[model samples]
Target chain A: MKTFKLGGVHPPENKLSQSAAIEVLPLPETVTIPLSQHLGVPANPVVKKGDSVKAGQLIAKGEAFISANIHSSVSGTVQKIDDVVDTSGYRKKAIVIKVEGDIWEDGIDLSKDLVKDISLSPQEIVSRVNEKGIVGMGGATFPSHVKLMVPQGKTADVLIINGVECEPYLTSDHRLMLEKAEEMLVGIQIQMKALNVDRAIIGVENNKPDAIDHLMKLIPEYPGISVEPLKVKYPQGGEKQLIKALVNREVPSGKLPIEVGCVVHNVGTSFAVYEAVQKNKPLVERVVTVTGKGVKEPSNFVARIGTPIANLIEAAGGIPENTGKVINGGPMMGKALSDINAPVTKGTSGILLFPQAETSRKPVHNCIRCGRCASICPMGLEPYLLAVLASHKRFDDCETEKVMDCIECGSCLYICPSGRPLLDQIRVGKNETGKMIRLRNR
Target chain B: MNEITLISVISLGSLGTIAAIILYMVAQKFKVIEDPRIDIVADKLPGANCGGCGLAGCRALAEEIVKKESLEGMSCPPGGNEVMGEIAKVLGLEAKEQDPTIAVVRCSGSRENAPPKVKYEGDMTCAFAHNLFAGEGGCPKGCLSYGDCVASCDFDAMYMDHKTGLPVIKDNCVSCGACVKACPRSIIEIRKRGKKDRRIFVSCINVEKGGVARKNCQVACIGCGKCVKECKFDAITLENNLAYIDFNKCTLCRKCPPVCPTNAIHELNFPPRRQRPETKAEPAEA
Candidate 1:
């Protein structure tokens, strides 16, 4: 059971939705598809108000090299293209569509049969993935096509598929691996072919024995692919951490996995790739786990993109009367959604609701120089020092201290006995430091 | 024993004299000749070192003033015009008289104006909260009310009014502009204090559409242009569903406030208006 060499914590594995089978959520009446779901510059809207769109139609095109395209999830008439409040509580341009019926664009195979043949050339596969708007579906929502390109002079020798759904209470990836293991293997092969890699490894945490067992059984059929079960650790799903765990390769600071001749993709991303390259489907829907302590029935729903989170909550037995906070993802790294009406984008993996009593944070206490934050930081940066420097506006010092290396996994904030807001301050520091660095570069 | 003691004392005294002479020679060799006027200018400064003048500190400004040999672009905000005049007199240069300004919070989303729509429970610093969500009041551009401005004030001129959940600037603000820079939402501005320290400006910064802005805040400027149309001096400009008043052009006409439907225009330190018969009659008719 290999794990990353650096620090990690074992948060309570609140896998409440682990046993819940993935259920396809019904079509929402209207969907608000934001243009900037994936990281990087927002996609440019190609459709306008009153334009009738099919389910797989490209509504927004990723014009920038690093951006991802956006496709409509349902066949509908575009109600309006306007700024709507997103999960960040800030308004962003979104295309609101009134869903009419279950209609999909031409050429998308709406079949249940699995296609395993890798017929398309590697270059065609990459372009197809780009055209389909496939992105890393494990919360980051990075454009998958960009990752598949493999920058010049960098040779990708190995591919790592992240199946370690390490975040407590998030079982979307776990369910995907268990239910869609065969299709995911084909997806892994497609990604391997795109990167021209010979070997691929699927790293699943030991806790999900069923997923691990399921992948191991199916992996033999797909040559050059292996399943490696990792030690259960928080943040094991991080790309760098997963690479380090599976292949003993440490992605250097300020560098991508390609720097180490590796490329990591989430398990959900592999499944999405399978559908895109094989089934001719665009990345318009994903499995989102909705669970919490107060939830009546924690369940996993294969929901369409741009569906309002309120609909998902309603599917998970409705919002409890005592619900205090509803987070957009996992507890450690998720953002609290200010508006329940905010739509689920490609990145939303889970919705966690907390009771009123558990919503309030612990009272902040003075730092006792305990160095617990330093010990638990997986990036090996001193969070306490960064927090102090950031609070005092010492952004230059924060940069020198490598605040950019922080993964923001919330392990230090979780382990700190003094209840210091280490991660929050570090986030501020990282933001300021990044700005300073960008300015200096410019 | 007396002869030995005398010899030791004489040797020690000679060593001390030699060391003192060498120290004096070294000091002379590495001496920096600073103008004495810098000291006078520094003395005239309030020594707040608040960086309100965009200089490092009082000493830095003093050095700059003496080096520049003019008061051309140097004015100590905390010390105001009096200190600049004193420095100019000492330097035998004319000082430029400038209008005194004070920090005014442009947001009027008080507790009553914009009630909290969501509960914020994480870090209380406005910088952190601003990045985390829009705000408790659900206005993305309104004041966060976490007192970052209050914490940045060095003159003890700003304090958070718990009743309104807004920072109240005191008379001794000195127009240092620290609060203006401290605000994460850019809700505070340095404006010229009008006659009798009275001022009129739009208080809301929300740029959401009229209905959307009103949904989050009662006093949000809807960019209706009513105030812009009412202003005789062209002081008001409406853009992005928000209104801004140029203090330099405003003449205290007191016309825009009455015309503003949302009451987003705020008048500070002004005497109560005389009740008009039309206003009284409207209430009676209603």
Candidate 2:
């Protein structure tokens, strides 16, 4: 029953896609895979146009330890590697491949049998995860191997698995928890063994009472493990927020959870880790939620990482007649795609199609200073003042107000009655402040 | 008895006089010395203390100017150019003449012209509107008309034109660049004040495809390349489905405005046009 001792808002629990079973989406004729999917540096393309690649074959390799490798989601010939508009509405280089066959990499273990035990050393396990390009898979797409390589002087005592699908309309993690509970638990154990943590905790939001109960039942054998129910809140899955909610301790700003004697991993990330450590499966596929009022069929699908959103929508009964906007993730923090042809990336969690009525914006007026934004801010920063200072280009003032601490949760925007864009301007302010700080440092 | 009392009184009075003289000498010794010009410059400042000059106050600005030999690009926004000229004269420095400009919103999509793409029920700030989604209209690049710029403008010159859903700067605009910074899309620009308050600028900021832009707003530029074709001055350039008018090369000929099929090109400060034999009535919006 523990929750973070800070601001949180409970919007309507419109968990419409919760009950929908995850369906496998049909491959499209072509998939446009973006290289800049993960958090760090963009992956370097290893294939050129007209080169044939099999599913699961590495098409892009990591250029940095913090980056993830991109694998071909479908056996196809490279169509082109060109700039394409992504969900964030920014032009980024992407790899386009035309599907030719259902050929998968020969090394993949195509089996339903559970591999409960792996005797690989922690280093070997981490190496396999790195080689397979396994990442967080919880919308962050932070390289899992990089996270496992904790900074020196910091020791992890516990590995907390985040199974909280707190954002509205995202049920990928929930469904994954229900069906892959055993595999997820195995993944958590592997992570604990790798980190040499004594205990592991799987935190689930109370909204998913069934998921919590199922995980509890499946996890009875691992006495070192426990399932803690969390207060359903937006961004509960965020690293610092989750750590605070589970352990009642705040991870200091600019420091990871492991730095505070804990390491956290997502449930989906655990599954991906399990595959990487055991079956040598790279992160080539993931579960995607294709649900919204504008979607004719609201459902979840186990989609390939580079699957085009159009293909997922088609599998879910095509785009609805009223569809006017398509977001790449949940409504709270997702980026609305200008082009539906953009493919799913490692961080893609949901493809939310909003009808015209829900997608359009209202004319902005003066802020009435309702303070709802401050009340709902998880990071405990005032967004109204931040936006004002940003509008004035007061980078120094923004820094004084701790603009760098803003987690970009969109909660302030979600609660603002006057419909202010507090996050966007704050983003600009934070960027400016960061530049000023860097310049001063240099 | 009078002699003894007089002698004691004189001794006390001498001691008192000696103490007073010593105190005065000490006070003079410790008195701090500062340049007199600091006070004179401070007194001449506007005293608004707006901090737009990056100084603490008028006194601080005066002190810095007197102490620092270089004036550089420092000027108090509230004091206008006259105060700067005075400050420069006092410091024996040259006051830089700046071009007078005003904020011009590049978007013409008002509620009547640019319909809402989605109804926003969230906060009513332009910053929030831009972050939450694209403009209320389907055009992602169009003016949000949320009035963040209008609210940010300290001067009463900028107002949200209800008909256009965009901020309009009056002739009294001081070119503070406050509105230009407030706009999330960067649609507000400090354009030169042309003769007779007339200048030519592009009205559309929509970078979406012509089909999408037209679907979002009726007044959006369709990117038909018509203005580019008609322009003989080579002042217009199109990119990302939006046309921009290069004010430097523009001759204010008003040729591009008439040739723009979508009326995306706007001409300002021009005299009333003479009646022509045939002309189309303004299109009714909404």
Candidate 3:
């Protein structure tokens, strides 16, 4: 099995929800759909209070080239357009709607029939993906259409499909691959056509033998695609890592994967693309994994974009008695939610509820020249040195050391025996260094 | 043996004299004529090198002062008027009197006022926490209470009060503005130390909509304009669902605090209020 060359770690798999089928969560009472769900500038809201909207209706329009359109996940009456607390615990502009009935917009084909034919031209497909607001559903909600439109002078010769759901306890992608293999394969072919690529590879970690087996069996039917099982690594699902693992191409520092003639998309994104292109569906719902040691029933639910996290917890057998913290995503790179009522966005992959004993961080100790952090950093940067410099506010040194190259995989922090807050300080340094570079460029 | 020793001493002495002559000539050729007053001015400074004067250090500030030959746009925050007066005396220039100032935390989102909605884990620095989420109190603009400001203080003028979960500035604070810069949310402000060390200003910085801000913090300034209307000195301005009081224009009338519906206006070091007969009579009527 192939893996990224530089550095990686093996965390506990903790795939508790792997057996749970994706259940369709009932519509929430009120869905607070935030406008800024994806990377880049937030979409401008088009509807106001007292306006009636149907499911799959365009509620906000993405004006910027890099943004994604926002659609209503449920048919409802717009209660108000105001700032509501989001997954980040910060107030952001969102459209609050009161659930009325299950009314979907026209032109949407709501059926279970599989359409294996690709009808639209490549250009038309890209615009159609953008119109549907299909973003990468593997925790980084980057607009998929932007990825499809290869930049000038960059030729994409291969499309890499990331099926390595490496984050512990996150099985949304795994379950999606197992259940919707045909749809995802079709989506992969659609993406390959859109990117003008002749070959595509689906990279899955070796731990998920079933997913690899399923995808391998289906790839022969879908020409120009294959499955490559990879060594189980923490961040194998990262774009660069997955590319390096499958195609032996390392995306250069501070550059996108397309620079290496590759475009990476998540399995969930491929399924979403299939739904959007074949069934005329917009991206409104996603599979979210709700799992933890303390959870009564670790399950995966196909939840709407604006469903409150509290509702998901209730469906997964209410909050555990000893639930200490509720993280919005996976354990390695997720943020703890300050408000349980904060609505889900496109980027949310899993909701992990840790017990109180595991929630508290270990006591920090002085560095004893262990070099474990540097040894385990997936980006091959010195995490301990960067953390020290960041704590001391030496941003110039941090920038010179290539702080921007950090993928924030938390492997360094995970491997550190002294329990140093390596990733936290590195994040601060990256933010400050990025700001300094931007100011200098301006 | 005596003759050899004599020859060795004479040769060594001559080489030393020649080397000394060359060194003296080189020094004279590349001499830097520095003004003597720079040293004197630097000596008069507090030597904290806190960079509160917007310069590199005391030495840089001294060089600037002596080079400009005027203290018009230069002032050392750590070394207040006394040190400046001493430097002025040494330079034979008149000293400018400047108002004394101190660091004041603007947010009143204490533990009791705005309790933590969620527990925070990971690095405790406010900078990291600020980048991660709004805050434990769910106020994006409120104080995070992680004490980055306290950690940045060089003079031990700040400490985090556990009861209030806010950094308390001491009297020794020279208004050096280190805490002001250390705050990620810009919750600490350098305000004028008023007469008898009394000051009045709004203690909340939340700019969310009135209902939203109040839901997170009980003492958030809702931009109700009550303080703006009550201020006779035109000191308060309401904008962006928050109220700000201009310290320069404030006359310490103490009228705005009573009219504030949320008690967001904080009066510091002021005398206790006298009991009003109307409040006592209300209970009797009831």
Candidate 4:
């Protein structure tokens, strides 16, 4: 089993939803589709009040090269377009639609037939993925179309598919691989075709032998595709870490996976790409894992883009009375949602609820000079020093220490003996340092 | 040994004398002529380097005052008029008196007035909360209740009231504007301290429409323009679905708060009002 060379932690694998088969969540009566779902400039809404929109209709268009288009997830009358509180606890412009029926767009293929024929050319595949507004479903939500366009002077040699749901309680990708193995392989082929790569590898943690076995058995039909079992470790699913695990290549600091002649995509993203290229479907719905110790029933649901998380909780056996915190993703990297009414976005991979006992964040203490944070940082940067510099507003020093390279895996904060919030402080540093770097570049 | 001691003493004496004369000559050549009144003015000014006057320190400000020979724009916020009066007396210059000001929180979204719709569980600092959510209440433009202003106050002049979840400024506040700069949501305003400390200000910063703003907080200013119409001094203006009263133009007639349908205006330190006017009561008795 291969793993990244740098430091990592072994958080307990709380796979409560591993056995829960994916259930299709019923369409919400009203869907609030935020325009700025992806990690770029927000899309401009094309529809206004009283406009009748069908499912998969382009409600907002992504005009910027790095943005993703937002589509309506239900056929409904446009109730209103207004700012609604999203997962980030901030108000953002979103299209609100009251569902009237299940009418999809004229061009979208709603059938679930497995179409394996790759009829689209490489250029056509790229353009279709772009039009479908496909994004990295592994939680970063970077516009998939932008990643497909390999910059000049760079060559993508191999494609790495991330199947490692290394976060403690997440099993969405695990379920995605097992339930849709054939579709994923075909999706990988589509991604490979789009990237113009010869070889592709699916990196799965050894803890998930069933998924690996399933993919391994299905790989015979697909040439030049391999499944590599990785050492079961937290953050093994990180793009850089996964690349280093499978291909023995390290993505240089501040550079992308392309620096090492590779491009990484989530298994979910691969499936989305296949659907977009072969089925003419836009990226709309995804598999979300709602599980925790406090949850009544941990389960996975095939949720639409604008489904209210409250509905998922009700489906998963209503939110427990003692539940004190509701997170948007896995325990290690997810954000605490202020309201359960928040709608799931392209990046929401899991929703974890914790009881009052488990939600008690340890009181922050002074650094004890134990050097645990430095030893456990996956980026090989000193988180202890970064925390100190960021707290002091020394952004220049933070930039010099390479704070922007931090992947925010929460590994350092998790392992710190003194309960220092290294990741929290480093987030501030990264923001300030990124702004300073941008200003300097200009 | 005796002869050597005498000879060394005489040589050292001559060398010391020569070095002392050279040092004196250098000191005289590089002597910096400065106004003696700078030190006197600095002594009269408080030494707190709060930077409220936009200068480095009191000593630096003294030098600027002595150089400019004018106190047109140099008012020590911490020491206020008394210190400036003393400085002016020493410099033989007419000192301009400026009114004292203090920071007042413009939002009244207390726990009772504006109930929290959601709970904030992250960093308890107002700045972090301002970026994270619109407070627990749906008012994105109001106080975050995290007391960032309280934390930024170097004078220990602000504190968070647990019952109300709002910051209360102490009387010792020097009007230094530290809290103003510290607030991420710009909820704290430094307004002119009125006669007998009586002042009025709208206590809501929610810029949402009347319906939306009222939906979030019971006392949110709806910008209904009732206060604007009632203000006889033409001190109020409505913009962006929010009403702002100019303190400079406001005569403190105490009319706007009574006309505010939502009771969004706050009155501070005003005497109690009688049921009827004294003239009318006297005439009725007669």
Candidate 5:
């Protein structure tokens, strides 16, 4: 088994929802579909208030090249397109829809049959993926269509499917791989065709032996696709790290994975591509794992995009009495959700609730100069120094130190004995440094 | 001494003299010619180096003023108009007059006033506490009382009132705006120091709804429109579920504070009120 040849940490794998089968959550009364769900520019909403829309109907269109379309997860009338605070504690424009029916769009094949044939050309496949609003489902939510459309001169030799759900307490990808093996394989084939690549590797962590075994057994049915089991490591699922782990190629700093002749997509994203190309479904709902040590019943839910976190918590057995914080993803990279009423977006992977006892932030101490943060940073950047620079507002020094390269995996924060808020400062540094880079470019 | 020792000593001495003369020549050749008035002007300005003037330092600002040949667009906030007057005198330039200002902590949600429903066991800094979660109280926008503003104050103008668990602005505040920038919640505002330092402004910055704001703090401005309707001078306006009083229009009549149902409007530097029959003890907070 191969792993990324760099700094990594093995946090306790508290896969609480590992055994919880995916359950389809009941339709929430109201879904707050945010216009800015995906990573790039927020989608421009096309529908007006009081307009009735069907599920899978495009309400928000991707405006920029690096954007994705947003569809109403439920057939509903648009209540209003207004500002609503999200899990990140920031307010953004969202379309509030009142669910009336579960009517999907016409021509969408909402069936259980697996479609293996890829009838559409590569260009058509890329457009369909964009029209379906499929993004990197591995929490980055990068527009998949953009990733598939290789730059004019560059070429991708192989497509690596990310099945390594390396984050502790997140098994949505693992479960997706186990349950939707055939659809995922077909999805990978479709992606390979779109990328004009013949060979593909599905990288699964060895911890998910069942998923690995199932995929391995079915690999012969899908030509030019192979399953590679990886040693369990946090953030090995990262695009750069996974490309390095599977293909033995290092993506240069401040460069895309394509620079190393690879493009990666999450297992769930490949499944979505399969559905969009074959079943004609848009990216509306996904599997969300609501789990925590303090939760009454950790569970996995196939939930609509706009459902509130409170509903998922309710399904996982109402908010625990001792609940202190609810995170939108894994503990290592999840954002501490400020409002429980904030709606789920396309990138929501897991909702973890920490008890009051577990929520006490450790007291911070001056860095002992232990060099542990530098040693454990998966991005191979010095988090301690970056944090100090950020606190001093020395964004220039941070930029020189490549603070923008920090993926904010919280590895340094997790491994720091002094409880220094390394990632918090690095996150701010990345923001400031990114702004400086953009300004410099302009 | 031997002849070889004497010869070696003379050679080393000649080399040392030559090196010294060369260094002197280089130093004189590279010496920068600057206006002597820059140093005098910088000495006249406050050396607090708060960077409130948007320059790197007071010395840098002095160079800029001398280079620009005018004090037209430059001002030192800490030293106010008096220091600018002194600098202008040094530079033979007319000083610009401006109002002296002081920083005001807009939140009055103290420990006794806004009881914490959730205890936050995090670092004792507003920046750290802010990122951890909302304030201990239910209001997400209230002051966390972690003393970040006090820490950022270059001058000892702000202190955490331990009894109230809120930062108190001292009477001698320079209004350098460091605290205003340091506050993560942005609850500090630079306002024109009124005559006798008596000024009136809303004490709460909570933008939560009426019911939600009142639940978190006793002094939260719930945007009930009471202050707006009661004000005869049209100085106060309600926006984003919070009331803001424009100090320029405010007369400091002290009428809005008493009429504010939640005590959100605060009056500062006023004399002790005389006991009146109509005066009453307010409701107690948790």
Candidate 6:
């Protein structure tokens, strides 16, 4: 099986929610939508506190070039606009709504039937996706419109749909591929049209054999679309890693996948894009997996954008008695929520509840110099050296070692038997060094 | 010696001397003009090259000063006030006097207050803890108790207190602020060292509610607003369930110590007062 030439670690594939079908979660009485959902800038609030908003209505608009728009997940009256704590423990301005009815926007075509063809121009499709606030649902929440906007002088040769649900214990993408195969195919075609790419590949991990077969069967109707079964691997969904795994090309450091003549989209993102372009439906809901040993029930559900995590946990039969941590995503890179009231945003993939026994509790010991972390780092960085430099307050030295390149995948942390937190210190070094560089430039 | 040999030797010698003199004259005439004040300022600097002042070295700083029109917050750490004053005099500029400060870790959550949830047996670094988890302890905001602060202390003023699992500042602390930069939690702060090394600060960084903060560390600031109410000078502001004391408005009245519910606010350097005056006096009159 061909994998990315760089380092990767295969931990146990604890995919507990693989068989769980997507169920619509019960709408909460109130929803709190935060403005900063996408990667770049925080969106500006467009609706006033007393205004009534329908499902898929534009609630917030991007204030900067790199930001994405935000939409109302449900028809509701604006209860309040106030600062709310997010999963990361930071307070951000959020829109609170008291749901009035299941009234959707009149323009949105809420049809169960899949629309195969979209007559909209490529630019119009991109604009619709942007207006609908469709971001990449593969956990990064990058603005979809921005990704679709190929930079000037650059062209996308191949569009790759990432069906590789590589992160262990998370099957949201897997279920999306299995259940929404046709929608995904249509979405892939839509993406191909947007990128003006003739050829497209949907890379699914062999673990989801059924999804591969389904996609392969449906892809024949679309001439340029094909499904390729990828060997299951952790972080195979990373844009660079997936591109390399699927196409045998390496995206150079600090370069986009497009630079290597490819564009990768997550399966869920493709489905959302399909809906956005075809039916004029905005992205308001996403599949979320609630799974772990600490939860009584492990399942996947189509969760609304602004639902609180505590409600999701309650729907999953509540946390067990000895739940040690409540992570907002997969165990490897997910943030442990300090506030259960933090609402779900666009990029949340899963809610992992780990029992105290299953949680990692190793003390920071001396580096055995095993070099395992460096061996498995996909970015080809020496995490040990960066850790040492950061430890000694040699931030400049850390910068010289290019510590900023760490993707915070938690591979180094997961592989380190000595329990050293290489990512934590490296993140600080990156931020501090960036600030220093900025100060120097000023 | 033969006449020819002597002539050759004298000719070579004269040629060498003339070339040396010409080189010397050229070196003097075409010398690159440099500001003499830069040298004077550089001489007055401590030359530790710590780069804390955002410059490369003492020479770079001197050059920048000579080139710039104004100097503000541009004092070197190793030079201290005396050296800064000297440099200021040399440059024909007035030096601004700043309060000498040192970094003091407020959180006493060493092993006793904030117990470690897991034994981190990897690289001993606060940065590692910050990235991997929020910290080593149960509190997401608590200090990692790693020696990143100690490592950043170029003056050797801060050291890890083995028993407390916290960095202790010594009298020799120069307030260089390298430790502040190194600390991932931003717990290490540069504050004025009150008379006789007395000072006050909030020890805990936990902004979680009282119960939750207490669950993580015994000394976390729960943002109960008690300190804000107790302060007579209106020096404190509570936001995001965290209390911030504005040092400029703080009167050092020690009014907040008793009011803090969680002992998150710390007071140091105040004289201990006796309950009662001594009534008896030594036999004086003969």
Per-residue lDDT for A178-274 in model 5, tens only? 8889999999999999999999999988988888899999999999999999998988988898998999998899899999889899999999999
Decoy 6 TM-score against native: 0.80
Q: In candidate 2 chain A, where is summed lDDT lowest over 10 consecutive residues?
A: A83-92
lDDT (10s digit) by residue, model 4, range A1-442: 6899889999999899998888999998898999988999999999999999988888999999999988888899999998788998877889999999899999777788888989998889889998999999999999998888899999999999999989989999999999998888999998888889989999999888999999989999999899999898878889988998899898888899999999999999999998889888888899999999978889999999988999999999999999889999999988888889999898989999998788876787778999887887888989999988986779999998999889999999889877776777788778778878999999
Best-to-worst order by TM-score is 1, 3, 4, 5, 6, 2
Q: Candidate 5 overall Cα lDDT vs. reference?
A: 0.88
lDDT of 1 by residue, B193-265 (tens): 8899999999988888888888888778888887888898989898988889999999998998887777788
The global C-alpha lDDT for each of the candidates, from Candidate 1 onward, is: 0.91, 0.81, 0.91, 0.87, 0.88, 0.82
Worst 10 residues of 1 chain A by lDDT: A212-221
Candidate 1 CAPRI category: medium
Q: How accurate is candidate 1 locally (lDDT)?
A: 0.91
Model 4 stretches astray by more than 4 angstroms: A364-366, A432-442, B1-16, B28-45, B55-75, B81-98, B117-122, B275-286
What TM-score does candidate 1 reach? 0.95
Model 1, span A249-309: residue lDDT tens: 8889999999999999998999999999998999999999999999999999999999999
Q: Using Cα atoms with residue i matched to residue i, what is each candidate's TM-score against the true structure?
A: 0.95, 0.76, 0.94, 0.90, 0.88, 0.80
Tens digit per residue, CA lDDT, model 6, B139-218: 76777788888887777787888998888888887777788877777888878776667787888777666666676677
Q: Top DockQ: which candidate number?
A: 3
lDDT of 5 at A272: 92
* DockQ of structure 5: 0.22
- The better-scoring model by lDDT among 3 and 5 is 3
Candidate 5: stretches off by over 4 Å: A361-366, A436-442, B1-32, B109-141, B162-165, B204-218, B222-243, B272-286
Candidate ranking (DockQ, best to worst): 3, 1, 4, 5, 6, 2
Candidate 5 per-residue C-alpha lDDT over B1-286 given as tens digits, one digit per residue, 9 for 90 to 100: 9999999999999999999999999999999877888888888878989998888889999999999989887878888898998888877889878778889989888887798865655345677667666777756788888898998888898899998888999987888889998888899999989878989999988876676678768778878777798889999999988899998999988777777777777888899667523423244222
lDDT of 1 at B67: 94
Docking class of 2: incorrect
Poorest 10 consecutive residues by lDDT, candidate 3 chain B: B277-286
DockQ scores for all the models shown?
A: 0.69, 0.12, 0.75, 0.35, 0.22, 0.18
